[model samples]
Target: MFMRGKCIGCGCCTSRCNADALLYTGEEMDADKVLDEVFKDILFYRKTGGMTLSGGEPLMQYDFSLKLLKGAKEKGVHTAIETSGYYPGKLYEIAKYTDLWLYDVKIFDESEHIKYTGVSNKLIMENLKYLNATGSEIILRCPIIPGINLTDEHFEKIAELSASVSSVKKVQFMPYHPLGTEKMKSLGREQKYENCEFLSRDAILPYLEKIKDKTDKILEIM
Candidate 1:
């Protein structure tokens, strides 16, 4: 019923919810407070292991994210961010504090990108180039969705970026899976890829071979 748009945006449902499952997932935390939580895993994040800020788009909270990254850096922890490269000047402002960028390029073509993601890829492409200019280490993260973007052209475009961009030190493939279908169903929402199967590492084997033939950059399947 929720996914069918039956529930209005009012707070009635949340106020009445007994399970406490749909409450806000975020909390107010200053950089220090967040760091307190992070340091709990200090032993586990010994050497190359450190904080990786993922999102809903971390740049949405630019000031907090910057402060958090700054605090982590001061403590000598390697910092990485998984981002869509959508935020304009903010990325450059925080680039120095970010040790690595798990930058996403969902689709290479602007039209196709807008068709699938409902946004222009122009800013994303620009931000990526700008980030590259900053000499930041980047691992190009590409999602290989079976029916959506599991195509030769998409892989080729990714290969092109690795070959042309000096900062793109490697390529990482994030294959699509139906793992979220159960959650979507639980919420009474329709799953977009309901018919799609989990993408095994072997599903991208041929594309990997194709990309390998195009660039010498390191490749990882995640």
Candidate 2:
């Protein structure tokens, strides 16, 4: 049911849909099937590779996500999740099986976050704090959305959180990429960051310098 994935810009499927209906994309896979797929690549997981549950917010499907992490852990495979931190799921239980948390820090200001993402950042902030308290190994994946959240206050807080949170293993700055723009256009829809240019490492250096002094944690631009 998730539409947030790979789409070639063929435009063949664009006209198939009716008025704003949900796209019938992404095959359904139960936890066991998914684990089977994950295990197929177990050889690569010898050192660096592992299972990461991503989403339109994986916590939205609490039962399936739980089953997945539990199964992966039982088989001695590493586990991680990339989450928005916006869902109210059983974090402690998920943390028990998860080896790392790739938590997104979209924006720092509450009003601005609500304006941009259509929700308050209260829950995200709360869950992040709770996760840190649980000693969950975390990577703060901060995306620098152009013309929206790329601000001084945002960078400063990213540094502060990186330095203060004992569980944060690293602060990763994700540059803006126009990967979704073409996919949206092919689907006869418009994206918010349409026409935005991809950011270069040179562009992220200033922000990195801003946070470098405040945080001793490892920082990398992706």
Count residue pairs with overlapping backbones in model 1: 0
Candidate 2, residues 1-222: lDDT per residue as tens digits? 436356664544645756636345566789999999999988888688889999778899988999999999898888999999998655888889989999999988899888878899999999999999888799999888778767788888899888888999998989998888888786667476775688877888888887798998999998
Residues 37-79 of candidate 1 have per-residue lDDT tens digits of: 9988887777869999998799888998999899888888889
> TM-score winner among the candidates?
1
Q: How many clashes in each structure?
A: 0, 0
- Would you give me the overall lDDT of model 1? 0.85
- Candidate 2 displacement at residue 219 in angstroms: 0.9
Q: Which candidate is the best by lDDT?
A: 2
lDDT for residue 136 in candidate 1, whole number 0-100: 82
Model 2, position 131, has a per-residue lDDT of 92
Angstrom error of the Cα, residue 72, model 2: value is 0.4
